[model samples]
Target chain A: MKRVGLKDVAAEAGVSVTTVSHILNNVQGKRINAETRRLVLEVAEHLGYQPNDLARGLRLRRSNTVGFVSDEIATTPHAGQIIRGAQEAAAQNGLMLLMLNTGNDRDLEDKEIALLLRHQVDGVLYASMYHRVVEVPQRLASVPTVLLDARSDDPAVPSVVPDEEQGGRTATRELLAHGHRRIGFVNNIDDIPASRGRLAGYRGELAEAGIDFDPSLVVTEDSVAAGGYRGSRTLLGLDDPPTALFCFNDRMAMGAYRAASEAGLAIPADLSVIGFDNQELISENLFPALTTVALPHYEMGARAIFHLQQVIDRAEPLGAAVHEVLHCPLISRDSVARPRT
Target chain B: MKRVGLKDVAAEAGVSVTTVSHILNNVQGKRINAETRRLVLEVAEHLGYQPNDLARGLRLRRSNTVGFVSDEIATTPHAGQIIRGAQEAAAQNGLMLLMLNTGNDRDLEDKEIALLLRHQVDGVLYASMYHRVVEVPQRLASVPTVLLDARSDDPAVPSVVPDEEQGGRTATRELLAHGHRRIGFVNNIDDIPASRGRLAGYRGELAEAGIDFDPSLVVTEDSVAAGGYRGSRTLLGLDDPPTALFCFNDRMAMGAYRAASEAGLAIPADLSVIGFDNQELISENLFPALTTVALPHYEMGARAIFHLQQVIDRAEPLGAAVHEVLHCPLISRDSVARPRT
Candidate 1:
């Protein structure tokens, strides 16, 4: 289990370590014979010799490392897909990620960035667990940085976020395609991009289908399961209740399920329900598996690295910041169906 | 927002960059007046200078980096806590983690270890997403390595894992304390350590209470909701069915809930149920919420780094590998109650 080094390869090939190093590194001016070069390579391959990346990186003035600094990302379920996506893309490009969780502490973030820079990382990824507006740290100004699952007011900084409006539209369109015209939208009361964008998408999609937006059918509450329960209860208790329910997230949809059951409405028979944020833990385990709109978390992570790499490799600063927004796909399960007559 | 360097501090302090470097780095045996040293330090502090860790690390032969190699840790809900624990602990010790996921592919794992070695990481954390027995990868022999949320068959390798048998005893004892003698155990069909350990704990606790082991009360199925439902239904149909049920996991406990509802039984009133692996998404959202056992994912992660640091700092090889077992605490919710007597 000893690390195979140049000396081992050279000794096995009956050549000096310098010759092996020069041949393996492909020193352009060296006049080594083709046979010798081939023999050194064969011996290195046979010995599974791995060149020291740190020494190579130092000589090339590139660390082959990207610093990934996140605010409470590692605590959320979505952390996995986003980090995994970035890691896989980085690995494919012969790079690794140095992860530092700041726990949303600005002071700690400043220190973390300083630490990342001290390690000579080629670039840093400023990531947020969920889509939000974030300010790039001042210390990060010197290094190439790209925001993941977040955006900034300054248009000149690159960022990658999920298209919330598009995701909302996709969810509503699914219900509409299933012949659900009278749909109750159980929305979150938060004044964030998700709430506003999803609501806009719901209204726009309803208008497209020649259905007037029913203000009474839309109820806003907390975003958790209890919030969904209260919202759904209010909607179902209306004098003219909607036939279908479009929940803000899977947790809310979970609450909506309870509301329907209490009202003696079996899913897709007496009522239908669709949700957003396809958290597989809830979406898959629900009695009647939940149908939800998938957040492009993994894609956002991958694309952030892709954009960051482009910025790092470019000689000139980007003419304009690339604010890329990815699409959300519909995950169809057992939740949605045609409205009952 | 520009990076502060020795030259900037020296220029501001009316001194040479070389003088600033020597004073700041505290190079021994250099002739310098106390006034000059004091002035250089003040200027460096005012300019917010940070010493280059990479250069310092090269001199010290320590990278201040730990390679975290895991098989699909980030893909699970538990990924967040475990990673956060390790990251927080590493940060406390002026270290960062270089994460590489292998997706359980041996070839990829081997390549990842090689990559970690090339980066000159002081040590590596070989982690598994779940508790299981794993063989130490041969490539990891060159680095100080510790297992996280997993154990090694080789007694000489250090590891930190949750005590599954203790967790089982805790869960069963809770139900027993609630005055339930006839407790049905809903077990997973998988022959993993969790299954074996939990079952053993259940039987041991029951025997301690002077109750005979009843094979008929235990039913094995898939470790998911559907399996829980099937297992619970079978137990409920018994001529003299148990008044309480213990599910192997929260997903299966979800299924048990459905079975109880179909049988017109209310939780804790008609049948008391307790689950394992307190996945908040499932355990918290379930009606009345589920009382379950929480696996010490975060603790395992933190302890693994703690043990790895010791191995790295020790002058001599460890005489005996430390295999630390963490405790699983019972999360009391509304799931269990005195057996409706």
Candidate 2:
């Protein structure tokens, strides 16, 4: 005897497969004749149809579900936007998004990925709170996987990251456009990819403008307000101070604001400031409303899912990995002004 | 012939269950004999065993998994700690946690919960970004469900929430201990539960101290910095100004700090401030650092999972619903000080 399926019951009962599904799953949107509903149920019972989606998933190897494994993105201020982007993108492609937060622990990540595999997730999306290169777990390599705001050492693993260098260039060029010949950059330590990329962009922009790179004006420290405070103080205390200040991130820019206030300097009128990662909590509510660059967090998330969908549609692990770097847009606010020449 | 299982294969191959599992799952770390692993694989192949956990889950009616459906918690800044608490609690009892971010959309939440049900999740954990009363989805009532950082009107559903009243009392008590009798209050609007509970705590603490409640000193507004700033200004402009200010939240407290600064009033020496909700980004980074009450987010999550475990262990819907209210602790920092008399 052939194994009973939903189609067999649908054919025998003279009902559509959707009708059989609605009756078995108890989905209540549609209305059907009572007699037809009873007939469909009877035929399903007669054929011994199990309505076992688990069995179907196992046989077809497509659960129509994707696992999202994250290090810290899910619990950050950026979590809302990133999830909105990924969740909507996944839904567009008829797949469910199952999320897991590993808290940057390799052991916990291993456990979570194993669990996802046991559940037979069709593909995996590994995202991080910040943009950087990361190691892909061996368990994930077997599935069609995409990294969001992160990268794996393995060339085979595809990734989508923000263009930090372009963001830095945009910030510097904006100050330059305001006729500031001497600019100071309050940067983060170079160990981070974001810091490195942004610094390169800053230097590249200055060089392009025929302005001699001033080592005295560049200060690097932790990506915090205190770091920004100290960096701003040092730049202002220089023999020839910069009229414009560019910070690596919004937090650092907030620190610069405090330092400028303590120094009795009014924003834009005396010192212009620009920041990166337009964190709304800081930038929007700040006294002067900071001008900054928005990290492509939401876009990165959406693109990762779109790429994962393409990868999962293929029969096997993708042969050629795609590394897509998206651009960061500048958010101009009240913080920028022409230098007092 | 009896249906082949992992136990049967382990007994026939004369190996521990762990070894058989490691070989099948391809989990790294355990050093098993290569020949023994090969023998176990060969025996399992001869018995025609299908490694179908989904089928097993269906037969057992318990997937050994819990579905955590969240409206906004999974995509908020507090997502990390809450998830950590829930995930750790679930792992302690041999259960996998599969998460879904519903983005606060009812239709999407309905779809996600349906998918979780299809996967035979043993229990469900519905959480929110912040504490509030929520409507329990009708489909969730069928399973052993618990609300984390939220409450439901339905008595049958268990819930865990932070005790905001205790937090408010704790904040007020700190100021009272510093010899500040005439205190100003910047409160959130009365409609929100957090605001109501916190205000009640503030009044309760003042009553305990025998300080007459001065309606003139209390100003309610939105739970933001601007609200705190305006409230502080109003209180300070009064005939007898308050020596200290207790804000409903950290954001409001930041506004109070600005008001004090504008008046050339040094923190601690001239005007003391205390805030609720120890949001590190706002509280810790603020100059002098804010002293605020820490909401019991992690504990609420852990307790809810523990409650769900008990419900699942009972093998039926719980008869009595548990509403656990955990306490909030005050984090003392430099912002609080003795009044200048």
Considering only N, C-alpha and C atoms within 3 Å, which residue pairs clash in candidate 1?
none
Interface CA root-mean-square deviation for model 2: 7.3
Q: Supply DockQ values for each candidate.
A: 0.57, 0.29
At residue B85, give the lDDT of candidate 1: 91
Candidate No. with top lDDT: 1
Off by over 4 Å in 2: A1-38, A41-52, A73-75, B1-38, B41-52
Candidate 1 residue lDDT tens string, A1-341: 34577889988999998999999887789899889999999989888787776667666767899999999965578899999999999998888999989999999998888889988898888999878899899988777889998888878789998888988888899999989888999999988888898999899999999999989999999988889999999999999898899999998998999898888889978888999989888898888998999998888889999999998898345789899989989999998889877
What lDDT score is found at residue A9 in candidate 1? 92
Q: For candidate 2, lDDT tens digit of each residue in A175-279?
A: 999999899999997588899999999999999999999899999988888888889999988888999999999888988988898988889899999999987
Per-prediction fnat: 0.68, 0.25
Instruction: Report model 2's chain A TM-score.
Output: 0.86
